[model samples]
Each structure stands twice: as structure tokens, then as C-alpha cells.
Target: MRAVAALARRSVRAGSGRFLVEGPQGVRELVRYAAPSVVDLYVTAAAAQRYAALVESASAAGVFVHSVSDEVLAAMADAETPQGMLAVAQQPEPTLADVLAASPRLLVFLQEVRDPGNLGTVIRAADASGADAVLVTDSSVDVFSPKVVRSTAGSLFHLPVVTGLDAEATLAEVASHGIRTLATEGEAALTLPHVDLAGRHCWVLGTEAQGLPDHLAAACAERVSIPIYGKAESLNLAMAATICLYASAAAQHGTQ
Candidate 1:
């Protein structure tokens, strides 16, 4: 219990090279896609019974399973209402070089995005939209944080998520591959529909509060905006990213 609780902290997860995946959805996905990295799984008796197949899968993959009381499961979990299932898995470390080598046509670059839910949703959206990978600047929230992991619903293990990147260096590196960087802003002259989304490109998103920095926006190949048709003053970062990513997906696939 003490060791599992310790993994909740960023420092501990960093030192241990491991992070927690909470809830049955996240755990099921983790077990299904990343079974090799799963070290241990904790489940309540009820959860074990309800998700017997998942537990069996984990066991077959050689992951140690611990059946504990609900109280005990809560003690080791980050959420108040433990879902009766959690898994500890090694963090994947992928480099920009590795992502580039895959020749991804669509990408999302998060700049100093501090909200875990927002970051995770963007990753999920990226994966759903068939984006090749997701990149995060060093200033962004820890990608492996509990909330982020849960928000991903297992998409975290589906794609290459290169984290701790230098903003300018990554921009330059992707540019070398003929990937156009499009900085999303509310005030940009070019709107989403106007931008050319058919080619290899990357959508650069900023923090929730500040959006993208002016300097970074200027550095991008194009500064684009998503049109607001309703009374809402602006779109949530995650919502905007989903729209942009899907727009790019539709365009690139010629389904529009």
C-alpha cells in the first residue's frame, strides 16, 4: 500500500520508471495493449469477479495480481472512489527520431498544457483522428500523471507520445520532415477551414489560460483559428483540438 501510494507522486514515478493506471477501462486497455510492461495489478474481490477475463488476461501475461479489500484498494489509488482495479506499468520513452521515422502525416504538439484532462483528451482525440503521434513540451503536465492516464482511456499506449520536448527544437525537427506546424489561436487571420490540412502537418496547442505564446505562434508556419458560430466566447482547449484534428483527418483522407 505504501509503495503504491508513493507511485502517485511525480518524483516517485520518475525515479521508479513506472506509473499507475486506474479504473477498469484504463486497466483493460493497459492489459490488452501493453501487457508486457504491466508489472502488477490490484483488484478488489468484486472487480476480480466482474472483470474475470481481464484478471485472467493479466495473469496469463505474467502480471502479478493482488486481490484486496475495497479499503485497501482505495488506499493505493489516487481517486476517491477506487474502481476496484489498477495496474502499474513501465513508462514508454520514445524519442522524436523514433516518431519521425514512422513518417506520420498528422500530429499534435502540446505547448505547456498544464491541465491533465485536457492533455489526455487531446491525446485521445489525436489517436481517434488517426494522427501519427502526440508531442508535449517540457512545460506541459506530466503525461503519465494519474488523471491524464485515466483520461486517455488506454490511448496512451496506442500511439507514440514523445514528452519533455524543447519547443523550438521540436518545431525545427518536424519541419525538416516537411511537416508544417500550425499554431492554433483565437485571433489568427487564417481560420481552420482555410488552412491546408491535406499534407503532412502538426497542430500546435497552447496552455488553457494563455493559449499559445506570441513568439511560438510566430514561429509556426501558419497561425490558424477555429471559428466560433455560437454565443460561447471560446472553445475549450480539448474541444478545439478535437475539431482541428478531425478537420485535418477529414481533409487528408479526402472524405470532406
Candidate 2:
């Protein structure tokens, strides 16, 4: 119990080169994916019985499983109500080069994004849109933070997520690959729907409160906005990103 609680801390996770994935969905997907990095699995006794196949699969994958009381499961999880399952796995990271090498046509870059929930939603949206990868700038929140991980609902493991890069340098790097970088702005005259997204596009989103910094916004090849048809002042950061990314996805995939 003490060790499980300790893994909840970021410092401990960092030092141990391992992170916790809570709930049955995340753990089941981890096992289904056959991710070799998963080292440990914890579940409640009832949960083990209910999800016998899942437990068996994890065992077949060679992940050590421990059946404990519901109390122990809660103690290990970051959430108040852990869905009776959790897994400890190594945190995987990829570089800008790795993202580019994949020849991803659609990409989303989270620039200076500080909110863990918003960042996680952004990653999920990116995955849903089938973006090549999601790049999180160095100034963004810890990608592997508990809140972010839970919010992602396991989409964090679905796609290549490049982290800890300078926004400006990443912009330049993707631009060289013929990937036009666009900074999302709520008020910019150029709306997302009107843009020509026939080729690769990397949409860069700023923080929730400040949006993108002026300097970084200026650095992008273009600054584009999502049109607001309703009377709402503005869309939430995650909402705007979804609209922009899907717009690109629709435009590009429609052609293919």
C-alpha cells in the first residue's frame, strides 16, 4: 500500500521510470496492445473474478497481477473511485524527429498549454481525428501527470505524443517537412474552414487563459481562427482544437 501510494507522486514516478494507469479501460487496453512496458497490475478481488479473462490476458502478457482489497486499489489510484484496476508501466516518449519520420500529414501541437484536463482532451481529440501525432511543447504541463493521463482515457498510448520541444523550433522543423504550421486564434480573420488544408498541417494551440503567445503566434506560417456562429464569446481550448483538427482531417481525408 505504501509503495502504491508513493507511485502516485510525480517525483516518485519520475525516479522510478514508471507511471500508473488507473481504471479497467486503460489497463485492459495496455494489455490488449501487448505493451511490453507494463510491469504490474493491481485489482480488487471481485474485479479479478469479474474480469477473469482480462486478468488471464495480462498474465499471458507476463504482467504480474496482484488481487487486493478494494481499499488497497483506491489507495493506489489517483482517482477517488478507481474502477478496480490499475497498471504500472514505463512512460514512453518520442522526439520531433520520430514524429516527422512517420510522414504524418495531420499534426496538432499544444503550445504553452498548462491545463492538464485541457491537454488530455486535446490528446484525445487528436487521436480521434487520426492526426499523425501530437506535440506538446516544453512549457506545457507534465504530459504524464495523473490528471492528464486519466483525462486522456488511454488515448495517450494510442498515438505518438512528442513532448518537451521548443515551440519555435518545432514549428520550423515541421515547416521544413512541407507541413504548414497554423496558430489557432479565436479572433483571427482567417477561419479554419476556409483554409486550404490539402497538404500536411500542424495546428498549434496556446494555453487556455492566454491562448498563444504573440511571438509564437507570429512565428507560425499562418494564424487561423475557428468561426463562431453562435453568440458564445469563444469556444473552449479543447473544443476549438477539435474543430480545427477535424476540419483538417475532413479536408485531407475527403480527397483520399
Candidate 3:
């Protein structure tokens, strides 16, 4: 449908409170984790046959499934290889309270990141590292963007990704909950391992270019750096999130 294709634009997806997800993996994950949120599923006839169990599972869950022409599916998809399947689903809604209720011990925040690929990768890293949730602050890429959804592969459905938040307020609130807020600043003297991660912690990462605003970084409990043993210039957003999150995870799990 032309309407589904139009969802490739961030404004359109936001205006409609809906988003389109491509690939069978994302669709299958949606069915498994959040079936009630699915609005409709569109599949090429061949995809319907290839991924018959997914079609059956979605249908059994009461999600509307349509097997259309390959051309129609192509129109609905944004990926170069569309997996011949696409799905429209309501955007996930998770409030700050919802995030806190999960008893989050470790958290990650992206402050004003612009790249959808980076955002999605950070989300996937968060899920793999067993983070409770991820927060994308103001000026960040829209999490529902098709590019972001595609980059997430399926982790977007695995964890709660809180978006469109005020970086200052959210960090303040997280700090109020007795969590140590550590902003990743390359120039900082404290190393990631120097921090006491055995307690609750929240790692705040900045943009690729500007990093965090100076005042925001100052507001955190401490600013730390991931020690670079090699001659690399710096770690990208995804690598930083992955390293910081897993550090906490290892500290928590290994000690147990």
C-alpha cells in the first residue's frame, strides 16, 4: 500500500502512531513478543509459503495477514532485500515509570544521537548485554524510522526503548533513584573499570560529533572513559554502549 510506503518518513510514522517493520525475523519476533500491537501483515505469495509458520502464528494470534503480489510487497518494504514480508504495527509506548518498574539495575541512554543505525545497534547491544531498558533523548533519530527498525534486526522488540525524552530531566530522575550516572567522556580521567559498577549504574553516551553537552556531562555523578589500549581514535556509539552495559552485567552476574 502507498500508505505503508509513506511510513518510511519519520514524520508520517509519528503522525500515524504506527510504523512499518521489514523482514521475517522482525515480524516473527513481533508475533512472539508483542502480537497485540500488530495492525496488519503483508507478505508476498512466495514469502507466505516460505514463512508459513509465521503466517500461521500471526493468524492464530488474530493479526490480519495478507498475501499480496510481490510488487505490492516491494512497494511496502524499504530494505534492498525485503525478505518479501512487511508488517505495520503500533509504535511501542513505554513511560519512565514503566522503565523504572522493571527494577533496572543497569541503564543506557543516548543523548542526541542522530544516526538511526547507531541507535538501533545500541538497542541491540542493550538487549544482548541484559540491560533493563534504553532511552533515547531529545534530538536523537526517531526510533520508529524504517532504517532504525531494520537495523535493530529484532532487538527493538526484545527491550523497552524509551524515546523523545528530555536528557536533563531523565538523567536527574534516574540519579534520584540511587543509580550512579556515568557519562562517557573521552577526556575524563576516570576509566570505565575505575567506576563502582557493582551497584546500580546508568551509562550516558553522547553524539558521534559533539558528544554530550558540557553542562550535562558535569551534572552526572562522574564522567568516565573507556580505556583504549590500541591506537584507535575512539569507539563509536554502539561499541561504547556495548562495553559499558556488559561491564555492569559482568559485575552483577559474575559476583553472583
Candidate 4:
């Protein structure tokens, strides 16, 4: 138990790069998708009694289940609800090359997006919208933070998320890949619906408070805005990113 707790806190776990996964839903997904890498599965004694099916499933999958005391479980949990089960599994490494390898054609670059919910929502949207991967530049929240992971609601397992990108290098790399970058601004000439987001594109979303950085904006192939006839000053970063990514998807898929 102590070792499991230590592993959860540390960044490294053998060569697998494991991280702790909490909650019933997350554990279930982990067992289904990453069963082999699951090291220790913990459940409170009461929880074990209540969630017999989950316990059985983990046990059948060769996951070691511990009926920990409530206090022990609480101490290990990052959330308040402490969903009966947690797993330690490998954290897949995603790189720019890997992302491009998946789909060299289109991608989304999230610049300085500080909110975990926003970051996770964008990742989920990227997955659903068929984006290659999400490049999180410096100034964003940690992609693997608990809140971000929870916000993803299991989409974290499906999508590739590359973080810690140097803005200039990222722009250069995307440009080299033939990705035409687009930035969202309040005062852009073209609106999102009018842009030709057909091929090899990178839709860049900016910070919530401030839009894209000047250098990054300059790096873009074009600047576009989401025409808002409503009274709101600006749309939320995640909503705007979703609209932009979907627009690109629509153009690429010929659904526009």
C-alpha cells in the first residue's frame, strides 16, 4: 500500500511511465484498455463489498485488489468522492513526430490555455473531430494533472497530447510538416465559417484572458474569428477551439 502510494506520487514508474487512475469509470477503462500495465488496484473494504463486479473484473484481469481501510483509501485519493477503485498504469508518451505520424494532415495547437477543464475538453474535441493530436504549448496547465485527466472522461486514453512545446519551435515544426496555422482573434478579417481549413492545418487557440501571442499570431498562415452576433464579448477558449476544429473537420471530410 505504501509502495503504491509512493508510485502514485512519483512521476516515474519503471520503464512504463505509470500514473495513478482513480474512480470506477477510469479504473474500468484502464482494465479494458491497459490491463497488462495495471500494478495495484485499491478499494476501500466497504467499497469492495459494494462494487463486487468491479473487484471481480479486476481480479479476473490479474489485477491485485486490496481491501484498504477507508482512511487509507481517502489518503490515496485525489478526489472527494473516492470511487471505490484506482489503478496504476502506464502513461503513454506522445511526441510531435508521433502525432504527425498518426495524421500529418491536420492538428490543433493549444497555446497558453491555463484551465484544466478547457485543456481536457479540447483534447476530447480533438479526438472526436479526428484531429491528429493536441500540441500544448508553454503556459498551459499540466496535461496529466488530475483535474485535466478527469475532465477528459476517458478521452485521455484515446488521444495523443504533447505538452511543453516551445512556441517558436512548434510553429517551425508544424510549418515544416506543411501544416497551415490559423489563429483565432477578435479582429480577424475572416470568420471561421469562411476559412478553407481543408488540408494540413493547425488550428491554434490562445489564452483565455489574452488571445494569441504576437509572435505566435505572426507565425500563423492566417487569422480568423468566430463571428459572434450575440452580446458576449468573446467565446470561451474551449468552445471556440471546438468550433474551429469542427470547421476544419468539416472541410477535410467534405461535409461543409
Q: Which predicted model would earn the best TM-score? A: 3
Clashes of each: 0, 0, 0, 0
Q: How close is candidate 4 to the true structure, as a TM-score?
A: 0.86
- Write model 2 residue lDDT over 73-118, tens digit each, in one string: 8878888777788888888867889889888899999888888899
lDDT per model, in order? 0.92, 0.86, 0.90, 0.79
- What TM-score does model 3 achieve against the real structure? 0.97
> What does candidate 3's lDDT look like per residue over 43-137, in tens digits?
88889899999999999999999888988888788887888899999999998779987779888988988988999898888888888899888
In model 3, pairs of residues that clash are none
On TM-score, who's better, 1 or 4?
1
> lDDT per residue, candidate 4, 155-208, as tens digits?
777667887798888888888777888888988989887887776899887899
lDDT of 4: 0.79
TM-score on alpha carbons, each prediction = 0.96, 0.95, 0.97, 0.86
Among the numbered candidates, top lDDT falls to 1
Clashing pairs for model 2 are none
**In model 2, where is the ten-residue run with the lowest total lDDT?**
26-35
Between prediction 2 and prediction 4, the one with superior TM-score is 2
